[model samples]
Target: MYADVTVVGAGPVGLVLAAELALSGVTVQVLERLAEPETSMKAGGINVPTAEALDRRGLLPAAERVHRETMERMGAAFGRKAGAGAGAAATPSDGRGAGAQRQMTGHFAGMVIDAGLVDWDDPDLAAHAAVAGARMVPQRELEGLLATHVERLGVPVRRGVEVTGFEDTGDGVLVSTTAGAIRTGWLVGCDGGHSTVRRLAGIDFPGTDAELTGRVAVVDMADSSVLDEGWVWSSRGAYRRGPQPGRVFTVEFDAARRDDAENAGTRPHRGAPAEPVTLEEMQASLRRVSGTDVTLTALHGAATRWSDNTRQAATYRSGRVLLAGDAAHVHSPFGGQGLNLGVGDAMNLGWKLGAVVAGWAPEGLLDTYDTERRPLGAWVLDWTRAQAGVMRGDAKSVALREIVAELLATRSGATYAVKKISGVTQRVEVPGDHPLAGRHAPDIRLADGSRLANHSHAGGFMLLDRTPDGAFARAAATWAGRVRSVPDGTDAAGAARAEPAGVLVRPDGVVAWAADEAEATPTAVTALEAALHRWAGAPAHEPVA
Candidate 1:
């Protein structure tokens, strides 16, 4: 079928791209070579910002189901008691109180559940505040949900069809696929790292392979009753542990041989998939390593070798055709950052694509896609490369891992690690020096008991605070519904200990400018308007139109 845009691959990245585009009212099509989405559970977890982004567009419920189900399995295997109280109960600082930690009992004994187990807060009320909380959903399940939503949004998806070739003809793109030939105004290659569209565009992918890294099975078990948590063990007697089951369990094959000097240049990907690794193999490996014998149900296998081709296309646009997801950048999966990165890419591109299709975006606006995303990709690649090296289990790497992982396990460490892994710590380079610049706002309850941040679209700048004169209302009108304003704060009685009075938040829910009422009228307005123009690619003083 012919359409405005055709996206290849219905994987998480591609589906997310499609859903964002469709939700933004772009006419798009998704093509997948697979007859059906994989049932194999993959993608161990997601980060905070991604959860917020998905929730902003109303897709969190479906996403949470997958995380909830997986975490349940993890809890059982880890010998943990089951209850919603697992993560909901607040722990007292003294470590003893009603809010203190709950203990595991019965079939599961002595296990404790913490913030790590909870699904994120309801997206409707929580997404706009401080990057929100992270929720885990297997990649396949996430993809299926997004694909369904995209189709529901009226964007057509053609399965079992692969694109063989495409030609960019300036005004539009002509695509040839297994299904047939079609023409479109825009073509997006969400296909993957080994993308045909990228190749056809004659773009070069530049980067180097990580040294001595090899493939590992990304296996899943039909039943995880015997397994406790995800663990990574090496011959050096070092392994990284995973969370309890109902959560994800990963078996990394970064096994080191007894004789490093005997190591060869060849790695294992070319080998035929080993018969689902036998239960005995898993039990033996666990016992030999962690002194734990856990039977496993094999799920799927993948190459985890570091393939760090940290490059976006020399350009994101080639006439009407563009690239997104792995087609644009493929890096090591150090922080479970791949899926989250792809989702953000979709969010950034969605609004621009929508504006272009809706006939409001200025010429050259889409070019910013590469300018903004490429550096982000490079940063992730570099950070992950360092992370992978630290996980190597070599003598020095193991020492570093011990120090780092210890820090990661504590409350402070968890917070620090989560922020980095979730992409929350890396602020986007928006143009401004406002107090709220490049930071997420904390969730605040208004005097009326409503949250200031909720399921708002990440397409326009929004001002949220407590002022009746309503400069926000006026600005909202000038932008034709793209800009939104909300008056949110406590009443006088509640204001004694409340935060500052006014805040301007970006479409992505990050606070762009914040101030008390006295400073809100001018300084904050200037900053908010400046952020709008920066993201919208217009002059700071230009009219909202």
Candidate 2:
């Protein structure tokens, strides 16, 4: 009935958040509505930053294994097809196959990025590749792993229940769920787009209207090679064929035809729950949009009805409650940034929330969750909007798409596109003189030969000391239990990568502060104390036994 944090929704974001909190020694609970796990591979593809975040938590191997298995499954599915169509019987490219590109980092609108051409050593772009390129795994599989990890942390995930409502009691929150009521220090909603907790918290979800209706389905087609060989953009909309026999993806930008969904077929109206799309409706839509009589013999599973109606919560927090994932923002699924963005939110908020509960968080540390993540969410919204804007079936939009594609052919343009879409260039504004500060700290190998990631604790900060000066070490000793000092006055041999004299990394692996010049003077020690206080509150000053 009582816990440090109660997370609503057992999706990837919620499970990850709960697990992170529990890993930080915070008691947590997860409530999910569905009694069982979903088998459908809904969300797929995590960006490079996501891969890095997972690796930082020692979760990369499992995720990569899932991705490998999924790739094999897709290959098998394609192999059984009657005819060789788009990507059927295809051999792995160097990730760059001329006009037809295979994206490992994802795409912008429909323009996929060939990551092989990228310089992974570039500081701005390389920050995203700390664990290699982007990885793709089924959403269900990812959630399953998260659930397992959370279970390992002893966090109970109660399925077949949901957060019905809650009341903020100032000090804590009284959560009302289908199972029962409970009191928790904080409540976070990661319950997908149509979130019940957000409604209960009276959060304002304000955004744009849904102008385009879309559908993605798995079907048994009479002819595997019926669709085009590659991405086909036409007067109706854009369309693409997946790797398997029946997997077909389509979009319809015709407003008049979209309105017909309300009559009885597929009502994809804005501000309404997406109705179950019928096979007949999909067939009609495909035929109408493509103007080709493609026979869909059988529907493999339920079709996903999507729209371009992007919306984000006015704010991520409301008193004792907070929101993340689709609950906090929703947008067009042009590129698979949603999962990465949501999981990143969990990675950012988890430690902050744990810090607050543990009573070491600096002033406004909790507020920064909304301040930092909200803009990133809005940035994604704008990215998706821009993609959708150039993807309108109109001549102007189509022309713009062509221009964008042409521009993407250039090195700088492609780099820019990939950087933005891969979430590599995003740098948070932290109070520091060094450019690397407030950014993701460089992964450093300590003098003891341990990786920076290995020393990172879920609830504590890491101080990387590279200089052969004991000033930073002395200052760090004052906050020893709170902020761990990695190197003790170790010199050039202290780091695996070239780094500054001293660096303090947040639990989230972001550089809080770093010294530009190495000096074992009182000035350096004083500055270290100030930085330590600014980020982790006043030092614990542990008393000697």
Candidate 3:
């Protein structure tokens, strides 16, 4: 076998998965159809959970640098001063005191939600408060970062190599590529919405058809003054201008064609149109949506046409062939969830798949990836669907949008939206009832000023024991090889509840188990052992030298 695992696609998700597999001592390789990384602007930024995932991998510094550069360019294009940093709190222009800054958490449809309205004092939002917020890094830059990381990890990413077909023989998968045929224990498809791997694997992709066509482009215009800045909603559709100059976005309702007869009941060309976007199409889209005769003269970079084609895989895994990122689920780029969702998929699946390939995974461990992440993918599809519903030009949609806007203006509504959009409220089912259990562990600070994130750079489970007697640490010794014990964390971030004696954080940063007692009782110890067996697999059964 060339490698234990073969990942089809060299995007952020595949690179991340490859890196995790390499870190976990499993051989992995990535194959991408494109000879070079795409330079188009896809996702404009990442949400909190994605940012935290980068932080856990020690890539946040590079991401922050890229974010700052992106922000500076955006600020220059908009003729405004950039924020102090990528995740720094912005001071409101109106000077409405400390908490009044307009937090650009995200927008639902065209209505922007201000996270500033959220009560920071609320315990539910403590995890968000403990970490850096959302960031504006371009997708191209992020791919560069991940590509570099995977290269450093010695994972081979062979471009210009497309997977033509694959056969899963139960024992392993034989992947036929343009270069040659290779044998691998596992095959993961991260190749985007129209995945050849998914098609070859015969996984069912079922979802709603596209309703509207949206165009986003950076272009030179004959007269830029004809269009309005920011979001402009009309009876026709909606158009947004000048988050950066020359960058325009238009969404026209009832503009997308339904699934064609040949493509019906399968992965349709409903997301991005198969044709390359042109200046004439951009001008026509802007004219219809803005109700203005704006003329785009020339396209600057790549122009993209997208639709609200929402879909999710019936199953993320079929025998030894699996899927992640857009290959697993796809939806409208509304709420900027596509990239973040894909990154989340990579994070959630990487370690588990790695454990499986490394030969120490407990029974049914690999299946948990599908069980846990599929629901999140479904939720994202619905989230974007709701946004699409409110974005239509019809009167009913307008009325619904008004009500949603009003709800979003309220404290509770805004808080809920922020928590959901920022991913602070995301939790998977785990063994414990503790609030932190199954959720991403907060970056707890140790006595040495290091953080739980610091220990995760090497890709291992973390046992943050806060008990005075190091009870949890002692209990975790049997899994010492797979789980690192940090017994002296002070939780300076105050993100954890006062009672949690310890937290067993999975390599993906999700809390597998947490105990609230001051000391680790026999019951707590047993629970910890069970969690270890469940997540990190069986203990080493040998004393450390």
Whole-model lDDT values for every prediction: 0.55, 0.70, 0.78
TM-score of every candidate: 0.75, 0.87, 0.92
lDDT of 2 by residue, 68-91 (tens): 565666666666522123221123
**Number of the predicted model whose TM-score against the real structure is largest:** 3
What CA RMSD would candidate 3 show? 3.9
- lDDT digits (tens) for residues 1-545 of candidate 1: 66767787777667777776765566788887767655432456666567666656656556555655655665565556433433321121111112211211000001122345222332222323332222545565666677677777777778888788988888888888887898987888776666667778877666544343222334455544444443444643323334433333232334332211211112221111223344445445444555554444552443232232244456776777777777776655545667777777776787777668766565766776677677777777776667656655467877877776666556555544434554545565555665456665555656665445453644455666565555544443445455566665336565532555566665555665666654347765665555555544443243555
Candidate 3, poorest ten consecutive residues by summed lDDT: 92-101
List candidate 1 stretches off by more than 4 Å: 83-134, 212-232, 236-314, 362-364, 402-414, 440-444, 453-461, 489-507, 510-520, 536-545
Superposition error at 77 for model 1 (Å) = 2.7
Residue 188 lDDT in model 2? 93
lDDT of 1 at 47: 61
Lowest-sum lDDT 10-residue window in model 1? 101-110
